[model samples]
Target: MRLVLRVGGLLIAICLVVACADATGVPGASGADVIFSDGFVPGQMGNWVIEGDNAGQTAVINEQLVFELADNNIMQFSTLPDVTFDNFILEVDAQLLEGDLGSSYGVLFRMQDSTRFYRFEITGDGLFMVERRDGESGWTRFVDRWTETPAIQQGLGSTNQLRVEALGTNISLYVNDELVHQFNDATYSSGTIALDAGTFVQPQAKVAFDNVVVRRP
Candidate 1:
């Protein structure tokens, strides 16, 4: 499978650097140290990169950020290039509008660059996984494989609230506000974050994300 990393505010599939607009944060929950928040409304994409081709596309439409994958064995992601966080709690509502049941999508955090990052993703079939990418050194899975969980809503058109709480080497993952996994890894201490959608052997996955908020834990 091929993984596409949006590095340095540009889709790096062609190694082309594109200019990105600055992001503006919307007010978050009361009493929370909100760092970044976006409703994904038309012009609020800010530094989030949007790119697509015949293979797939990442766009903002109808007040939501959407990712469509037209090819199998490839993952496409978009990141906010201007902000970095060492520790924070990020939550986003993600739904599979239409796609293969084997398709997967979720959040990527502590991204050091195009080479390294941590991923928390769930399939359309109620399975979740946590993985780490260490450049050319290869990938490391925190779990053996996709683990089944009741926390995730199964099937397409089901919205799941994905949350990640990261502090130092400790990280926790939650689905639908229920804790699903937790672990510690010192590979990355501080970096930006991203949202991604991917497919396996089956393609045509359209995933939409909205109401993203990043705040202090």
Candidate 2:
């Protein structure tokens, strides 16, 4: 995962435009205003930078952060620039606009860099996995393969709410407010959080993310 890089801009040091009061009792969360939201200001992409195929673009459409990809075997991520965190809860809503059922899109938090990070990915086909990258060590799945989960809303054009909590050696995964899986790994203690999209056996996956909230315990 560390050796892999492409074109995608990461939004760091930004604020979540709208606050989600509903996240009151999220895991590892306490009452706080730790949120980063982006509706892509008109004419301004804020602090985000793009990396990947020229056919892809990131913009604000209909008050949502949109990531449009191309028909290529590639992955793109949007994250913060110079900020990092550990032991926090990150939440976001992802909608698959156009893509195959096998395509994947989700959040990546505690990202040490373009090479190292923890990824909580869910496919449009209703599969989810917890994995991470360690520099040149390559990709290692904490949950192993992309496991199918009833917690996810399967199929394209479906929107799913994803959340992850990283505390100490314990990590918790949630889908649509349901606790689906939880495990522990002390490999990464701190890094930046990000939203990512990828193409698996298929090509050209488009996923939109919104209402990103990060709370620290």
Candidate 3:
């Protein structure tokens, strides 16, 4: 009887290990394919470059671009040149380092140049907006905007996920698992992607980002 009980326990342990292995193998949860990743390790600064004249923005010890806590965390692409995409899904995580009165940060897609692109932004106040730019219009008008009930201000320096799916002319934006915006624009099928930061009141703001994934569709 003792031997039989020992064997049963051993079998249970094997089964548990197998279950864990299976769970870890699952996609989109355990780990991603990781086409590109940056831990901001020093001496590994080729894939990205800092652009613009923004002060207080630098790669932190964690290998991430950290906006000065008082600057509204506004950092832009310093190295990646603009490119076009046909169909793809882009995902990024951004956090506000300091919650200012009107602090905001976001990702830009279908960006044709410094002046034009589709803007998807979120604020410390749990508000979000999607807008488009046509020529010199300056984010012409918002395609969608809303204030999330219960106000999802994670906290100062808390990261939040932002995802955009583009298939042909159709586009969709998701924030923290919620589908916030969707639209169709045939004017431009593809362009570059960018990060954006804007000033609000006086305290300034900082934003940090990580886990930026882009998958071709």
Candidate 4:
């Protein structure tokens, strides 16, 4: 069953049951032809957005891209404004510095804009989800629910390697070098990418992302 709730001014959905697989491998597109990369060196975010306000803040500090959400039910994301990709292998290291265990952070791909994209998210408590957004229309869950997997490191201060490989309608998601889900969708074909973090109930979510690389698949 799926439950949708209105919390802190945003609509949130929860999936009650889902089935997924787990398998391990290297985290990145190590030897593939590189298309883009960012180590997030301090004060050097050429293609990424940096912003701060009452809702949240995003910045590059200490060699990492960080997101700090100030309120519950709010989501924050920073995108590579000029980079667009299709049929590529993208990977990054995301660590939850501090937040509620239910908070999620991950990659958004085929992002036509802020409100239109595909997201692969994992919570600090070891649950993962895949979903899509289509502007004011609504959100769609690719899986039945937020499924649990042993692949995530589970807890604050733990870094998880998040990877996504997209080829045509086939998209695969991985966490900490383990395959978590693979599915097919034709909603979007090509667009930009982003890193995002969102809060569920409690606020103050701080997540840092690093070593982002995208390669031709």
TM-score of 3: 0.71
Q: How well is each residue in 87-190 modelled by candidate 4, as lDDT tens digits? A: 99988899999989999999889988766789899999999989888877778888888899999999999999999999999999999789999999999999
Tens-digit lDDT track of model 1 for 1-217: 2345442222323211121434443445335487777776666556555677888887788878888878766677777666789999999999988989878889989988756889999989999889898886767889887899999998889999999999999999999999999999998999888888877768688999888888897
lDDT of each: 0.79, 0.67, 0.55, 0.77
lDDT of 2 at 105: 79
| Model 3 lDDT per residue over 169-206, tens place | 89888887678777887866777776665554344566
Worst 10 residues of 4 by lDDT: 15-24
What ranges in model 4 sit over 4 Å off?
1-32, 43-47
lDDT digits (tens) for residues 1-217 of candidate 2: 1123421221211111111122222233334447544444444334555444454566667756777777555666777756677777777788888878777778877777677888888888888877777766667777756688898888777779998888888989899998878878888888777777777556676788776667675
**Which candidate number would show the highest lDDT if scored against the true structure?**
1
Worst 10 residues of 2 by lDDT: 11-20
Backbone clashes under 3 angstroms, per model: 0, 13, 12, 0
lDDT of 2: 0.67
- Identify the superior model by TM-score, candidate 1 or candidate 4: 1
Better of 1 and 4 by lDDT: 1
TM-score of each prediction: 0.88, 0.80, 0.71, 0.84
| Top TM-score prediction, candidate number | 1
